[model samples]
Target: MKKQKIEISLEVFETISELPKDIQELMNKAQQARENAYAPYSRFRVGTALQLASGEIVLGSNQENAAYPSGLCAERVAVFSAGANFPNQTITSLAITVRSENHEISEAIAPCGACRQSLAEYEQKQKSPIAIYFMGETGEIIKVASVMDLLPLGFDAKYL
Candidate 1:
């Protein structure tokens, strides 16, 4: 067997202010969306803001249910909404952030595996990269160029 390594590169920002003005605004919108999350059970709120090719920004917040499995993540909410409302538009970027009811996050927040796969599909559909900006607990940011980088070996239509 041959040894192989998979490495990914991401950009780190000391603060939201360090990013471009548009990204900073996107982060602000995500934070606002976080305030509206319906996460009574987990009390862990998350927000996502997507920027589309048409220059429209779409926002989403986590919605939880007592059944647990009925809950939807902020990333998917934003992506699905964009797909449903703006099918012709390509998503160019996304800003995500999370907050805990009881504690603070010390590092950047990442999307769950499911969200990564969902985002990978969108990346494939658009045939381009979708920049991901993850906000850390302390207001720092981590930027990924593509969801495909986050979910290696992701399934696509070609596989079916």
Candidate 2:
């Protein structure tokens, strides 16, 4: 058997101001959404913002449920909403931010495996790379060129 290595590329910015103006604005929106997250169980609030090709921005916050599996992540929520509302528009970029107990965590939080897969689906549908940006509670912002970077060899409708 042969073992293979995969490398992911990303950029770290010391501050949100260092990002492009549109990306900076999306990050700000994500931070605001984090404050409104309903996560009494995890107390880990997450917010996601999606920028559409039309320049429209959509925001989503983690919604927790006592049933656990029934609740959805901020990333999926934003993407699904975008799909439902703007089926023809492509998602240009996505920015995610997180906080816990009213304080931003100082480490970048990547999307969970399931969320990554879900994002990969949209990326495939759009036929365009979706820039992804995240931040730790503190420190610099992290930028990934596309969702495929997070979910390499991702499964999608193409296989079926």
Candidate 3:
């Protein structure tokens, strides 16, 4: 077997103010969405905001169900909403943030594996990169040019 390595470039910002004005606002919206998440079961709320080329911003917050498996993630909710509402628009960027009721989260929180796969599909369908910004309640923010960075070997329609 041959050895292989996969690496992705990332941008780290010391604070929200360090990001572009638009991105700063996006993060702020994500924070507000997070506050609205229905995550009583986990006490962990997640929010995601998507910026479309049509100059519209879509927001989604995690919705938890007692069945657990029936719930949806913030990333999927936002992406689905964008697709349903603005099918012709291209998603330019996304911002994600998480807050834990049990503790103060200072480290960045990347999307879960399932969320990555969902995002990868949207990116593939759009035929364009969707910038992804992620962070926790505070501290540094990380930016990736595309969801593929998080799901380097993502499965897509090409495999089907």
lDDT of 3 by residue, 41-155 (tens): 9999999999999879999999999999999999999999999999888999999999999999999999999999988888888899999999999999999999999998789
So what's the TM-score on candidate 2? 0.96
lDDT tens digits by residue: candidate 2, 43-127: 9999999999999999999999999999999999999999999999999999999888866588889999999998988999889
lDDT of 3: 0.95
Q: Which candidate should be chosen as best, given lDDT against the real structure? A: 3
lDDT of each model, Cα atoms only?
A: 0.93, 0.92, 0.95
Better of 2 and 3 by TM-score: 3
Ranking by TM-score: 3, 1, 2
> In model 2, where is the ten-residue run with the lowest total lDDT?
98-107
For candidate 2, give the lDDT of residue 20: 98
TM-score of each: 0.97, 0.96, 0.98
Instruction: Look at candidate 2 and give me any clashing residue pairs.
Output: 104-137, 105-137, 106-137, 106-138, 107-136, 107-137, 108-136
Pairs of residues clashing in candidate 1: none
TM-score of 1: 0.97
Compute the lDDT for candidate 2. Answer: 0.92
Model 1, 31-56: lDDT tens digits are: 89998999999999999999998899
